[model samples]
Target: MGKHRAYKFRLYPNKEQEMLINKTIGSSRFVFNYFLSLWKEEYKKTGKGLTYNKCATMIPALKKSNEYSWLKEVDSIALQSSVKNLEDSFNRFFKKQNKAPRFKSKKNPNQSYTTKNVSNSIQIQGNRIKLPKLKMAKFANSRDINGSILRATISRKASGKYFVSLLVEEHIQELDKSNNSVGIDLGIKDFAILDDGTVYNNNRYTTKMAKQLAREQRKLSRRYEQAKKDGKKLEDAKNYQKQKIKVARLHEKVANQREDFLNKVSTIIVKNHDVICIEDLNTKGMLRNHNLAKSISDVSWSMFVDKLQYKADWYGKQIVKIDRWYPSSQICSSCGVNSGKKTLDIRNWTCECGVEHDRDINASKNIKNEGLRQIQSYDKIG
Candidate 1:
């Protein structure tokens, strides 16, 4: 069972060291985009695709001749890994069997680089990490990465904090048949309502930190105004950076809380259940409606689903996604009657056959029944 996993470590750095980390990230991104453009141009002109090795070989020569000669300060192997990753991305996008490759934009310019030989003595101490380039820096191990490291990503979030992610390979053992099975209906108000009548209340992770975030943001905005008034817009004021880090730390705290909660919930579910059934939600499309947008984003149903999926796969449990069009919530679980006209405001209702139901619980039950039916059908066919 070849599986992929990653372990994360929290990095702590002095101001100077932090700057170095930022520079490394920027240089890596530059190297990737630069090589990507060069390869793309060559392919357009000569009608020949560049392999990863060929693309990587061109980097040293280009860096010596370009404005980014500073990239030489970092590990050359890390830079090569970035080019190789770009090549992989292009291969996926331009495969004859796949759709056409699309253009890259600055707003979405690919970020992060990788390094092989990741399995060689990578450990977390109190507040530092031992990387190939930086030797030993300040970082703390956040989670146990269950797999061997394959790559690492360095990127900044919207809150302007730098983070490094380790990608790894994890293999899991098969699950036994006697484990539990469950169906879950996700909701903004309830978080998750299981078929077993268990209701996990929404913690509203973002909302809980809204006050502190707004306060820091206010400080940042005031610093920005002062900087503009001083006519030094190119360089943000010292106060601006102070406020920025404050805001980033707050956002990081919120994210940490959310991740912790999700991990606990996912771990519990995975441990108890052999098969998990969930709705195939169109979260992106659903986010378009402004009315429930805040609540929806706060819950992060998409992230929840993704965590459930890979974890389920790792645990050798089945995660079945009912079709997006499937009317799980609209159908009465007792008699299979369609509650087609049900609205979001309808929390509880009685079926035509006189069965009382809590809307989410009923939906979860219907989902479980349908999932079982499908599994049985598949088994019969097999």
Candidate 2:
């Protein structure tokens, strides 16, 4: 079966193209929020929400209406996509899969709109891609995209930069298995610990840029106040906007650095190991501890795990997740004796079986052993 993949490229649109793209994005957001409001009002009045078809059917009349006539400036399909997204949101909310839909905010740092590929409206040709309304725009074209294009999503980042991600259907060949297996333990001090005793240091990208970010943010705050005092709209405040972009760039840099690190680490591990075992961590639950919340967010354990799992799937590798409550650290890997419990401060310990262990490495070993045992047990049952 073919796998779906997305290829994102840095986009460089001209001034006019950017204006049109922004208009399209704003129109989509307006459509989504407008329908969301109608849905809420209907539900409140009669205990029933607006259906997708109902909302979609109303769009033509909406565009013809004098107040929202500007909606016709953007592609009609993008507007319909917004309605579809709203319907999906409602379905998920009723199914208890996600929170209720909310209005889209214009002040959000990231702006995006998804557009379909009808009649090959989207095509990559020689470092440029043709898009609806925006027409042909230049992109980085760094990698060769080998797939039938499904849709394209154009997004603007907080750093005042634009990007386009192409979703495509492709047949991906699975990698040959090496029969190698390993276990990993995740932590704050160290990003990852493998059973082989390899330690990946927690490169705190946010911490590294903390001082610079704070400095720029302070400048932005002052400019914001100046704009307010002058009775100027924040969007029209040139000085304030400039400062805002600077602060945003710092944040963008930190994010890019973190993503790069995660990608490199995940790729290396996936390539080297066939069967990867790790704890099934309840990361959201773990974040409840205020003392560790900030640190955990910076570590981005969930993002790292997601990257690992997806890559493993792409390479035909297996990822075994042990129960979150499993006493990986408490049990001594050497003698299989439970030491009961250990504090976070206790990084090294001596087990009763004459074994001195590095806590993370020991836990990783236990995870590997437990994962292998579970596999064997499952095989026996099968």
Candidate 3:
């Protein structure tokens, strides 16, 4: 069996191509919203629901009957995919895996429809990528993709940056073999403290750009307020849309920067270690802490761990997630004594056993030992 893979490209489409992409995105949103509304109405009236396959089958007839000839402009497969996404969302909601369905807004929907397993190759000559509908565009890098392109989505961010995300399918290559293993402890001070005594400081991308972002946001807010007063707010207003794009571009820049950093860190750790251990953090609970809220969100610790886990799998390395309730930080790595009362501000402490411990580093060591013990126990059981 092959692995499903995905890659993203930062597209730099020309003006003409940009317009086409914008139109495609708008059309896709229309179709999705139209069907979603229709489905909701049917559910209320008939007490029955439409399946994605049903929706896909009905689209051509619906368009012909309704005189929505513009629907013909977008690829049929793309339309089917969009319907399938709705189906999957509903399935997940019914399964209690996700929240109830919500309406998509036109202001920031930033996505459109495209198909999978077709002639959807975006060429890369040097640093440029060729986008369908959109012409040749430049990118910062050409990812080593290993799958057929499924969807090509062009999006404009709050910072006015444009990007294309590609979903693909390919077999995953096995990772190299090694006996080395390492443990990771994630904390507020450092993003991760490894068992090998390395501390990767948390580079809070959003926090670092806070001041500049705030300035841009304030500008956007002022524009919005003025528009509200003058009744000048219309979706198609050129200046209003331009400001929205600016705000979106900033948010996008921060996200891109964070993703890049996480990818590099994950790649390095997976390549260097044969086994990795990390805590299963309760990110939702962590978000509730008022004092550390912004810092925690800016750290994107959960996303970092997610990247690490997936990259480890792709590289044939093992990743063990220690239970969140485990007192990795409170237990002494050397003496096995519980110091659960240690305050959060206490960065370092000397144990009664004369072991000097940096809180995070010590926690990392403890976590590593626990992971090793679990592995050994599993081996014994087998």
Candidate 4:
């Protein structure tokens, strides 16, 4: 009944610990890139690549050298994890699931390194967390974590904030059964419409802050252009770097706001319903229409679906994703008559059976009935 989960906490490290964390993150990135280059070179020459164990064993000799002796200053387990990650990347490439591994750059705003919990190297007590090399850094213990620690990934963000996400194995108790079921129709105007006529409006955070974001981005662009005209490396341009952080802060605010909204909505729906049904929307394909792409992206349908699925799993609820091609909107929920496709402008229509229907509400009802039918075909609970 136990599953692996990750809980992320904001970290407040002292100056010395912060320096060490940065060094560790850099070292891990370097290790991954170094091994990736070696593997690609070897494959080019002999049509073979180095295994993870081979790369891991070579770390000791690397740390002994003067050039890479700094790697020894950070946590060793993090280096091993780096090699392991490279192995996974190669595996995925060979499996045709991903592209070849690429080199990591320090210019990247986000950086992280994973380290395993060996012999109790990681621990949590009070509002402080014990990490390897950086021991006992204070963190925002907003929620209690009750589980056995497996590993921790420390990351630094563009806003110059550090965080740690701990992977833990634990049993999550299922929520009490609400005995309620509902279907959801996701749309651009209203984020979600339930079968029961409950509608959740799409609060477009991007449009709300569009003007401010454009202003800050203009500042960042000016700084970059000035640095380029002055013949200075963009990374070394103090003004540009400072402006980048300001722009990133604005983006961070929008992202946090969107995430908070999605989390609250998904949680509320899952906690109140036992069987949730939805269409398996082709959000990627929907983005191809330039006219509606901005609206679709602002709604963030995919992220909302992902949240619903996971929260449903945690709460022992069911999520039934109906076929994308199902003519939920075309079919009348009352008469079950397939009235041919209607254009987007036709928001309300009267069916041949003389039943008037709202586009989204009717589709949601059909989705719910279809989901129940499918569940019944398999002799499962609705």
Candidate 5:
């Protein structure tokens, strides 16, 4: 089987290259928005949306127009890829996997454009990458590019950092089989509680940076007000723009910290255990509780599970998700008895089987045993 992976590296473009990169970003955004407008109009007039091929065919005509002649300045493949992304968005919306596609905004902090590799149009030579229009842009090149590059996505973050993510096709060797298995219980108080009574505390990166974030936001708000008082648009205000970057950098810092922590924890768990079991949490529904929403979002339980899943796939490990309604917390792990549901306040409970249980630990143990039972049943049937 073919394995796909993406490697992202920071880009350092010169003054001319930076201008070209910005132009490419703007052109890609314009193409996406223009086609989106046409798609909306066509659907309204004929009750049919535009397909990828149809949109792609319109690109040449658009570039030929005097008003949109600038579109030809950027990479043609990038524009086509943008339309393809729109098609993907529509498909996802139709399948109920995501919301309907929205128009791309120039003011949006996240800007990106993707281009494919056609007969080695995209290549990494030493510390620089040769793009279609922006040639030989220098990158950090911290790691060697592995496998064949299929596509590359150039992106600009809110912090004004440029990055390129290369999607490559490669072969991955599965890790050796291990005998150990584990169950994980995720919570706001603790990041993860393992079946073996190991608890990983939540790092709370957002909360840790909340004070600085608040201060920076306040500064941004003040700048906006000053800009309004001076009869200048917020976008044209230098102080407001500077403050916005500051706030964005803080937000990016917190996000990076959270991602790093999650990667390490997931790697440790996936590497140590062969069979991993976790709850299929309804994160969307859980977020409805306004009181714990911030805390829950800060912990990012969903992201942790996502990392675990991909790592498990890569490492030839097994991941089983038990139903959310399985009452692992309320059941007695020692005896096959279901104790009545207990409120969250009851952290410890004594079951009728004369077993004292710690709520999270006991739940994890139950999850592990139940997951093993499920695997055993499947094996017997097979």
Candidate 6:
């Protein structure tokens, strides 16, 4: 099967390139917001939203207008891509895949613009990438881009770092078939508990950086207050801007740590296991618990599961998602006895069959058995 992948690399733009990038980002945002407003009015009158082609048709007229003549200063493809994005957002909303589209805000720290490859307009050289207006920008070409480039998205993060992500089409070889299988139980106390009694501890990246983040945030708040008292806008305050960047950098650090941890754990699990079993957790519902919410979010179980899913697909592995309603923790993995419900405080329990069960380990074992059973049933049906 053909596969699509993205190669993201850090970019170092020169002063002129940076200015052009900023201009394109602003133009893209303006185009999206402007067309979005028009789309809403059109939908109100016709009971149908504007499609991508319809939105793209307005770009030329918009550029010719006196008020929007500045739109011609940026790459035309970038503006069209923005309209495409807006249309995609609306389509997803109509299909109930996501919430309704909202207007892009200029105050948003993170900004991005997408442009497609046309007549080799986008290409990678020795240590740089060539984009439409911003000719040759230096990037850390850590690895070779091995596939046909479909499109590129250039983004500026809150930490003021620029990155370019290239979406490419490529063919990948599937991994050899294996008999190895494992079940995993995800939790806050332990990031993962395997059926074989192996445990991966949660790193609590956010918790570790919380103290420093709070300090920086407090300083930023103080700066904002001083700026307001001096009759200055928060954006115009140099001290406030500096503190904001500091806070953003700290948050970025925490995110990087968490991502690194998840990527390593997921890779190991997918590479080692052929059939992986995990619970289909209702993360949104779980987040409702104010007491455990911070700890739960810190563990990032959803991200781990997502990574596992994609890696499994990439490597010809299988992921079995047992229903969330399964009482894996309460059941006896040895004798298949449904012991009465237990509270979170109970870590271990002895079954009537004389089996000593650790809560998480028992859960993992049960998950494995149930998953294998489900797979076998599917095989029989087939």
The candidate scoring highest on lDDT is: 4
RMSD of each: 3.4, 1.4, 2.8, 2.1, 1.3, 1.2
lDDT of 2 at 121: 93
TM-score of each: 0.86, 0.97, 0.89, 0.94, 0.97, 0.97
Better of 3 and 6 by lDDT: 6
Taking the tens digit of each residue's C-alpha lDDT, what string does model 2 give over 1-382?
A: 7788889899999999999889999999999999999999999999999999999999999999999999999988889999999999999999999999999999999999999999999999999999988889999999998888999899999889999999998888888888889989999999999999999999998988889988898899999899999999999999998998888888989888999999999999998999999999999998999999988999999999999998988879989999999999999998999989899999999999999999999999999999999899999999
Please identify model 4 stretches exceeding 4 Å from their true place. Answer: 45-48, 380-382
In order, candidate lDDTs are 0.77, 0.93, 0.77, 0.94, 0.91, 0.92
> Which is the leading candidate under TM-score?
6
What is the RMSD, in Å, between candidate 5 and the native fold over all Cα? 1.3
Candidate 5 lDDT, 286-335, residue by residue in tens? 99999999999999989999999988988899999998999999889999
lDDT of 4 by residue, 179-293 (tens): 9999899998899999999999999999898999999999989998999999999879999989888888888888899989999999999999999999999998999999999
The residue ranges of model 6 lying beyond 4 angstroms of the native Cα positions read none
Model 6 root mean square deviation, Cα atoms: 1.2
What lDDT does candidate 3 reach at residue 147? 62
The sequence of per-residue lDDT tens digits that candidate 3 reaches over residues 246-355 is 77777877988888888888888999888898888999898998998988888788898888887776778998889988898889999999967788888889888999
Q: Among all windows of ten consecutive residues in candidate 5, which has the lowest summed lDDT?
A: 169-178
C-alpha-based local distance difference test score of model 1? 0.77
Q: Distance from true position, residue 5, model 1, in Å?
A: 2.0
Considering TM-score, where higher is better, how would the candidates rank from best to worst? 6, 5, 2, 4, 3, 1
Indicate the TM-score of model 2.
0.97
TM-score of 5: 0.97
lDDT of 3 at 115: 51
